[model samples]
Target: MHVYYYDENFMYMGEDIISEYDEMPENATDVRPKKGLYLPEYDADKREWFESASEEYIESLQPKPQPAADVTMLKKQVAMLTHQVAQLQRGGTS
Candidate 1:
């Protein structure tokens, strides 16, 4: 559920509130026709609504997993390189 506010000139103030569940109207005016209810801001860019709504929805979504690092593989590679350098310093033939 989302609650929106607007000024007299039809300018959007922003979302007043957001909820996971839907909200029912209490009074007649709440259900009555108005200019700004659920209406997108007139001065807003075309992508603005899509972006903001998407972000809000995404924020309500679950978290994702993070990838692991290859620490052992890196250590092995470093050790192999160090051995190669030592052999080179000793003038050893490959």
Candidate 2:
């Protein structure tokens, strides 16, 4: 059977599968939680799974957008490449 685990604060930790005949660990339970934005936490009083999303956690999952490249820098690189190719065609050093 698959068992889910929680920390002392009831935050979901992870899961493990064990033989049905074996004794379940103190921290483990057979209650499979629904997948959440983050793992769902167990509420002992409610006796059911509850989930919540953290703004910080959601922000962390998003990648920061990269800054746009300047056209001037690209133009310089192209010019340099053109000069090098001109020298290469004439059997000169790069």
Candidate 3:
């Protein structure tokens, strides 16, 4: 059997395989979320999974924006210094 876990706010925690004879956890259910376009939430009253739009979840899935252009020169300088240090450690002329 499979058990779906949820937090107090009914947010999804995760899921796990459980023995059919095992007792269900208080915050767990037998319901499984259907594969969908949006995240799913367990509706205890309906005993089913309902799709819910989650901005936080959607944002987290997205790639973070790159660092500002102003930092690029500093990063390049740091990299060059690091490479020089590595060469010095290897007894190679920088």
Candidate 4:
């Protein structure tokens, strides 16, 4: 098992290779954070965030649902009207 060690401030320091039966380190806590939500990686230059593989896999499996057909038609109509209004403002024909 991978033993994740943290600093005094609870910031991730690094990891250790301890046997499964080995006692937990003083600076380390086996109480892992709850799953879900992006996890922050320890980076000195800049902080980085990462989504778990399971989350990514699930997201890939489910693509974003497209807007409803009526909504799409309405959007098209709004665009056409907006174009017509702009043309009128510029003293141009329809």
| lDDT values for all models | 0.46, 0.80, 0.85, 0.62
Model 2 C-alpha lDDT per residue in residues 47-70, reported as the tens digit of each score: 667765678887887897655566
Q: Which regions of candidate 3 fall more than 4 Å away from where they truly are?
A: 54-94
State the lDDT at 5 in candidate 2. Answer: 90
Worst 10 residues of 1 by lDDT: 24-33
Model 4 lDDT per residue over 1-94, tens place: 6766656555665666788899888776554433553443333233332343466766777777877997899999999999999999999975
Candidate 3's residue-wise lDDT over 1-94, tens digit each? 9999988877778899999899999999998877863666888999988767777887788898877885898899999999999999999984
Ranking by lDDT: 3, 2, 4, 1
RMSD in angstroms, candidate 2? 4.4
Error of 1 at 73 (Å): 0.2
- The order by descending TM-score is 2, 3, 4, 1
Q: Candidate 4: which stretches are off by over 4 Å? A: 31-94
Which of the two, 2 or 4, has more TM-score?
A: 2
Best by lDDT: 3
Residue 18's lDDT in candidate 3: 92
- What's the distance in Å from true for residue 61, model 1? 14
Q: How well does candidate 3 match the true structure, expressed as C-alpha RMSD?
A: 6.4
